[model samples]
Target: MTEVGILGTGAQVPDRVVSNDEAGAAAGVDDAWVVRKTAIRERRWAAPEQATSDLAAAAGSAALRSAGITPDQLSVIVVATSTPDRPQPPTAAYVQQLLGAVGAAAFDVNAVCSGEVFALAAAEGILTRRGGHALVIGADVYSRILNPADRRTVVLFGDGAGAMVLGPGRGARVRNLALHTFGELAGLIEVPAGGSRRPADQAALDAGLQYFTMDGRAVRSFVEDRLPLLTKQFLHDSGVGPDDIRHFVPHQANGVMLDALFAELALNRAVMHRTLTHYGNTGAASIPITLAEAARSGAFRPGDLILLAGFGGGMAVGFALVEW
Candidate 1:
């Protein structure tokens, strides 16, 4: 089997910074409440003209540059996102065009916040057979779908993108990957309208069904229950252990949840990487964004074991073990 690995990583966020005060004002809360609940001090909001594709393209370009690979060398471009530019065309199409990756096959993956790892697994498989580089980007513009008055979600999400270039190289070698989904719990986090089942109409609009909604308590319970078990199983199946991991880069869902998870996982030697303090939960962008920041800062040592985990809507969870 061909050995594929991450060649580079990049991240991009909108210039507009939305402080907790700003996010909470309309949500009937205050900065203190938000910080206490989510540990989010601020987040980035996309400009009116920015969309998911734009951010994905920018991040992809950076990844390509860091990898020293030109756009035309890309064999595939996978964009993992839920808040796409439109309901029809795959957002990867726009990203491909913007990046001038004309020959690369492009598509989108909608595993909600778990999309990045899903996309990474997909790209890794393709590259193993196709023998070329792939750009995997996770981007979202949650600010567009959020309900201003919904304190549970509005204060927990932001707009941003993160990306990685994968190919046969000497970077972080992917050791194993795992993904899971609980379809029955899909309703725990979703936009109730605008899809085939619930069309966006006047009634749905009036009911505010188009906005993002989540059973926050239930979702938290799910994570608290499943994450540790899954992490242990994943490590065991991969012939590793929690203590073997040097770094844990998980989805920037919530700081409080992550803190608890970190403690429970007992990866005592591992340093948990988090960007949610300022970026909030940027949908699928969180993991890669956090990973990119750490990589750029010279955080990882050669041959270090790194774990990437993401869990979110679709009630899905994805994990990837990497040798950095």
Candidate 2:
């Protein structure tokens, strides 16, 4: 079997900076309260003209450049996002057009924040059979779906995109991958309206169901209970131990929760990468964005073991091991 690996990575965040005071103003909170809860001081919000596809394309282009690959040479373009540019036509289609990846097949994956790792697993399978490079992008425009008054969701999110180029080339060689979903807990985080089950009608709009919502308490509990167990199992199954991981790139969820979880995992040798302090939880884009930033900074040493984890809506969790 041909080995699949990450060839390059890139990330793009909007220029608009929203401080804690700004994000919490409408929700009756202050910087102190927000920081105590999420450890996020500021985040980037998209400009009025920017959408998910635009960011995705920019990150994709950067990833391609880093990989020394051209757009036309791509065999697949996978965009992992919850906030698409539109309901119709996948966001990856727009990204494909923007990058002039005319030869690539494009699509979108909506595992919420877990979409990036899911997309990576999907693209890896495709490339193993097709023999060409794949551009996997994780992008979201959470500013569009957030309800200003709902601090639970609004204060914890930002808009951004991250991308990785994967192919049969030198980079971070993928060693193992795992994904799990607990559908029974789907209601823990979601948009009540906009889907077929609950159309965005006047009634829905009147009730403010179009905005994102979450049971923060329940989500925290879910991660606390499941993440450590799953992560251990994943590492064990891959013939590795927690101490063997050199770097851990987890979903940029809540900084507080991450801190607790990291301690519980006790990956003594791993450096946990985090970007939520400045970028907030950018849904699917969090992991890739953090990964790209770390890679660009020359953080990984050759033969280092990197573990990527993502968990979010659909009550999904994804893990992948890479040998750099």
Candidate 3:
């Protein structure tokens, strides 16, 4: 079997920044309240003219450049996103065209916030099977789906994208990857309409059903109950322990949830990397964006153990253990 590893990473956020004061005013709250609740001081929102593909392509191009590879060298392009440019074509198709990846296979993966890690696992499988480079991108334009008046969901999401170049060569070796889903709790976090189950009709629009919705308390409870078990299982399967991990990059959910997770796992807070304070929750893009930022900051050393874990709206959990 061929070995697959990450060669490079890149991330991109829209030019527009939304500060907590701005978002809080819209939510009828104060900046202090917003920070106290989520620990997000500000985040980036995509311009009206921009779409998910735009962000994905920018990040993908950067990743390719970081890896010193050309578009033609890519064998596959996997974009993990729920917020596609359109319902007809996969967002990956538009991203591939924009990046001029003419030789690569293109598709989309919808694992919501756990998307990037899921895409990484999928890309690794493709590379190990086919012997070529793959570009995996996770991008989302949550602002488009946000109900401006709905503070809970609107204040928690932002728009951004991240990408990784994976190939069969020496780099961050992917030692173990795992993904699981709990469909029973899918409705805890989701867009109530815009899908086949409840098409985007005037009634849906009138009811504000097209907007994103999340039961934050329920989500936290779910995480508290599920994450530790999942982490234990993941560590066991990978034959590694918490102390062996030099860095624990989890989904940029928020400060409170992350703090709770750190306590639940009993891991050192210093080893945890978080981007939510500045970026809010960029959905699928969170994990990779944090990973890219950390890589650029010289956080990893050779032979270090890095753990990537993400859990979100599919009620999904995905993780990867890498040896840097």
Candidate 4:
């Protein structure tokens, strides 16, 4: 088996800062309390004109640069996002163009917040055949669709992007990947009326269902039970125990979600590095965003055990065990 370890990672947060207070004023939350609950002082909001592909391109460029490879070297480009620049053209196409990935085939994947790991799994499937290298990018600008007045979604999300390059392998790659979804809970955190379920129009807008909504209490309960349970399940399935793993890179859902997960895993907060406070939840971009920052900070070493996990809409969840 080729050792398909991660070659490099890159991420980009937006330029403007939306402080918790500012977000609170806009979203109707207690500013100080929001900070304490989520450990988010502020978050990056993309420029009004910025598109999801733009962010993905920035991250992809950085990832290719770090890997010392040109875009032409890649065989595939997988972009994961729910909020794409356009409803039709796959967002990855634009990113490939920006990265000069003229020869690489590109497309998009959508699993909401679980997008990064989902796309990575797709990348692994292609490389497992011993044929190619790939660029997996996750970028989202939920703020664009968000109703600025909606407190639930607005404050918990921001714009950002992250990417990683998957090289040809018979290598020690992602050893195991598992996924689960329960569409029954699809109503928990979702943007109703946007798609076929209830097509958006002047009527849906008047009904106030055009914006995203979350049954916050229900999602908290869902995360509380699943996060810790799945982490342990993944460790066991991979034949790895808590002590055997060097790092836990989880989806940056929110600080509240992290606080619950860390406690359940009986893991110290220090053992699991986080970047949610700085960028908020970039949906599928969260995990890789943190991974890119950690790599640059020298937080990882060769031969380290890495666990990448994510969960979000489609009521989906996924995990990947890799040797870094």
Candidate 5:
């Protein structure tokens, strides 16, 4: 089978930090209450003028720099974003132009938090059959859609971007993609704008459902009930056992969720990567951000086994097995 390896990774975030106290002051919640429950102390928010595309461009440039590749050399640009800069031009086009990848097949994806993995699969598929370099970026300035007055969500989300450079098969890099989705729960969490189902309207704005909301308790139930089964199947399909994984980077939605996943898989403590402490939950950008930081800091060994798992809106879930 042809292989596609991640050549580099990069990330970006705005200057603002919405701490629990700040969110509490804005949305009426106790700082301690926020910490005890979600385990998040602070989250970043984009400036009023900053758009999601700005983040994508920044991270994409960083990835190109790290990969030692230039914009003109890129064959494709895939940007994964549920929160787009505008309704018309796909965010990828801006990134492509910014990176000087003028003639590439640029586009955007809408897999919510599972976007990074989704874009990864798309890039892997494209590179496997065709021959060219592709850049995958997941950047979200979620606060634009956020109701600044809502506490549950305003405290949980942050703005950031992450990028990865993908190309022809490299030695034991990304082995395969184990991606899955459950559309029935699509409404569990979503934005009702810039799409067919619920086009942007005064109605959605009035209802205050245009931003983000979640059945946290319900999603937790789903994770506890389904994640184990999914992980097992993912492992079976990839022909890799739990014990073989050297590191686990599950979604950064919450610390407790990650703790549950790591303990369930019996993964070692040393290799687990967690950046939520400093970056908070960066939606689709979390994985690449952590991975890039690790790469830059020399955190991985030649024989390490890395697992990437993410869960998000639409009840979407995905995992990838890689040898680093």
Candidate 6:
């Protein structure tokens, strides 16, 4: 079997900063109330002209530069996002054009917040089979899909993108990658219209069904009930102990959820890297964005063990174990 590992990582957030005070005011709440609930102080939102592919291209370019490779060298480009520029063209295709990655196979995957992990797994498999470089990006522009007046959803999302360049290497080998989805819980977080199941008609638009909606409490309960079981089984099957993990990178869902997971798993807070307080939740971009931030800050070192886990809207969950 071919060994695939990450060659480089990069992240990019928009320049527009939306502070908690501003968001809270827009949602008819106080800043303190928002902070107390989500622990998010601020987040970035893309400019009017910027789209998800724009962010993905920027991050992917940075990752290519960091990896000391050019776009033309890429064999594949996989983008994970729910927010595409248009419904017709895959976001990755736009990213590929923006990056000038000629001849690279490009596509998009939508697993909501768990998207990055899913993309990583896909890229790893591609490299193993084709023995070439793959650029994987996780990006989201939730600001466009969110209902500004809905504090429950609006306060928890931001726009950003993160990317990784992977190839056959030995820097940080991907040990285990697993993904699962529960469609029954899919309605817990979703856009009620604009899809095949519910086409975007004028009635849907008038009803505000195009906006994102989530059952915060139900989602929390789902995570609380499922995370422990999944983590336990993943660790057991991978023969990795909680103590062996030097870094724990999870989807930046929220601070409260992280706290609950930490307590339930009995993991050290020092080993967990969090970016939510500053970035809120960037949906699919969260994991790679957090990982890149941590990596740049020297939070990871050679020979350290890292565990990446994420759960999201499809009621999907994904895990990846690596030895750095």
Q: On residues 10-55, what C-alpha lDDT tens digit does candidate 3 reach at each position? A: 9999999899888767678777888888888999999989999999
What lDDT is obtained when candidate 3 is compared to the true structure? Answer: 0.90
Q: Which window of ten consecutive residues has the lowest lDDT sum in model 5? A: 261-270
Give the C-alpha lDDT of model 1: 0.95
Instruction: In model 5, state the lDDT of residue 114.
Output: 86
- For model 5, the superposed segments whose C-alpha errors exceed 4 Å read 169-172
Global lDDT of each candidate: 0.95, 0.96, 0.90, 0.83, 0.81, 0.90
TM-score, per-candidate, Cα-based:
0.99, 0.99, 0.98, 0.94, 0.94, 0.98
| Superposed Cα deviation of residue 222, candidate 2 (Å) | 0.3
What TM-score does candidate 4 get on C-alpha atoms? 0.94
Candidate scoring better on lDDT of 5 and 6: 6
Per-residue lDDT of model 6, residues 144-208, tens digit only: 99998899989899999999899876467788998999999999999999989999999999999
Report clash pairs, candidate 5. Answer: none
Off by over 4 Å in 2: none
lDDT comparing candidate 5 with the true structure: 0.81
- Point out the worst 10-residue segment of candidate 1 by lDDT: 124-133
Candidate 4 lDDT over 164-230, as tens digits, reads 9888542226778988887999888787887777888889989888677788778878888777788
Weakest 10 consecutive residues of candidate 6 by summed lDDT: 262-271
What TM-score number comes out for model 6?
0.98
Query: Between 3 and 4, whose TM-score is larger?
Result: 3
* Candidate 4 segments whose C-alpha is farther than 4 A from its true place: 1-3, 169-172, 268-270
Show the colliding residue pairs in model 2.
none
Error of 2 at 117 (Å): 0.3
lDDT of 2 by residue, 1-324 (tens): 568999999999999999999998999999999999999999999999999999999999999999999999999999999999999899999999999999899999999999999999999999888789999999999999999998898899999999999999688899999999999999999999998999999999999999999999999999999999999999999999998999999999999999999999999999999999999999999999999999999999999999999999999999999999
| lDDT (Cα, tens digit) per residue for candidate 1, span 1-324 | 679999999999999999999998887999999999999999999999999999999999989888899999998999999999999799999999999998999999999999999999999999888789899999999999999999999999999999999999688899999999999999999999998999999999999999999999999999999999999999999999888999999999999999999999999999999899999999999999999999999999999999999999999999999999
Per-residue lDDT tens digits of candidate 5, residues 1-324? 356878777888889877878866768887787777777888888888888888899999999888877888788899988888887799998887777787789999878888899998998898878867889998888777777687767777778998989876553388868778898887778776647887768887788757777777778877888888898888888897877888787778887677776677665543678877666778888887777787778877886788888889888998888787
Poorest 10 consecutive residues by lDDT, candidate 3: 262-271
